[model samples]
Target: MRVAVAEDGALFRQGLVLLLEAAGHEVVACEAGGDPLVAQLSTIPADVALLDIRMPPEPDGGLVTAERLRDAHPDMGLLFLSHYAESHYLMRILEIGTDRIGYRLKEKVGSVDVLSDTLTRIADGEIVIEPELAKRLVERPRSEKRDLVASLSERERDVLKLMAEGRSNNGIASTLFVSAKAVEKHVANIFDKLGLHADTSAHHRRVQAVLTYLRSQRGDA
Candidate 1:
């Protein structure tokens, strides 16, 4: 895949470029800040653009750039890399829209496999959230008044977690050592328990289920 990178740290940016190259992906454009990336976007035909959650020009400059990219190219895939997976950042990412988007920890994404997989998933129009961040969100305390996630069985919750990681039913089945039919059942149960019965595409419903699960647990950490 063709990739563009925007990061302030020189060494980290170079290292990321090397990692992308090692993973057999092309780094079409590399910039030290979000502005530069935005300026060069017209010329760079990147399948996926990787941005640092925190960068120069401003603290949330990367997010600012992402907003511009969304306005200019709504369908472009965006993958945000952060040293820490803060809930606030995830919320902001969600606000920017969940389609063809991703948020991953820098340390975890350093692995060639992880980086490549994330880009591929984003390019395929999946919401690729960091697994660690998903775990942290699930572990957050639930409120008694509106706890849809609490209605799910343990196995269903497991399925939901993998869904947040952007895994397909087959992938979840393989991970949980269950048949694909069982995984499908669990996913259906999760959607039902979450009250996602509106007429919509399966992909839209899946995204809604994940958003509901995460928002239900979003609170003071």
Candidate 2:
């Protein structure tokens, strides 16, 4: 896939370019800040654009740029490469849009396999959230006495967390050392318990389940 990158740190930007090249992806544009990248995208074509969540001139400049890019290039994939896993950041990224978008930690996404998977998922219009961020959101303490998530079993919660991380059933099964059929059963149980009917497609239900998981973190459901 063709990719454009916007990062202020010269060393990290160059390393990211090298990593993308090593993965056999074309690096079309590399800019030092969000503004330049936004300008470049007007003329250059890229399949995916990776932006640092925090960049120069403004603390959240990358996010600002992402919103603009989303408006201008609705089909292009956008991924935020951040060093922090703060809920506020994830919330902001989700506000931008869930489809063809992702937020991943810089430290963890350095792995070639993880980076490749994340980019591919984003390109395929999946919401690719960092697993660490998903875990933190899922494990955070909730103050609500009557919680819907509390009704879930331990294993169902595990499957739900992976679902929030945008893992396929096969991937979740691989991670949890279970068969795909078992993963499907757990996902079905989660949907039923969460009151998600089977009227929708399984993919739509999966997305709804993940959104439910996110809503629970804020005591909204």
Candidate 3:
């Protein structure tokens, strides 16, 4: 795969280039800041753009760049690297749609395999949010947020939370230590309760379920 990267820290930027290149992906372009990345986008062709969500111009510079990239080149794949997986960041990412995008904590970059997998997954059109961000979105104080999400049982909510985290059934199963069959049943129940019967694509339904779960928990806050 071809990749472009934009990170303000020189050491991290160089390390990233090494990692991607060593993993058999070409690093076609590397920039020290978001603005430079945008300026070079027309000239750089890449399958995925790995970006840091905070940088020189603003704390949210990478996100701004990602949004601009989405507008300027809708087909571009995006994977964000952040110090913290805050809900606000994820919200903006989801606004770009739950496909061909991902969010991973900066700490995860230390693991070459995970970082490579995240980029590959995003390039292949998947919503891959880090676990911490998914937890926040799914486990917000239910006492205040329950009304809208009350239809789901506690276990069902657990399953849906992992689902929203972009986990496949097996992934959710491993996280919750439940059988894949049980996870499948929970997903079916979630779909029925949340009215995700719009189409046959489980991927689409999972995205819709996740959006519903996040929106409900984030209601008017």
Query: Which candidate number has the best TM-score?
Result: 1
Best by lDDT: 2
Task: Tell me the tens digit of each residue's lDDT in model 3 across 30-133.
Answer: 99888888888887778888899888568778888888888888888998888788877788888876899998888776777887878877877888989777
Better of 1 and 2 by lDDT: 2
lDDT for model 1 comes to: 0.84
The C-alpha RMSD in Å for every predicted model, in order, reads 2.2, 2.1, 2.8
| TM-score for all models, in order of appearance | 0.92, 0.89, 0.85
lDDT values, one for every candidate: 0.84, 0.86, 0.81
Clashing residue pairs for model 3 = none
> Which residue pairs clash within candidate 2?
none
Residue 109 lDDT in candidate 3:
67
Error of 2 at 11 (Å): 1.7
Deviation of model 1 at 28, angstroms: 0.8
**Clash count per candidate:** 0, 0, 0
Regions more than 4 Å wrong, model 2: 145-147, 196-200, 219-221
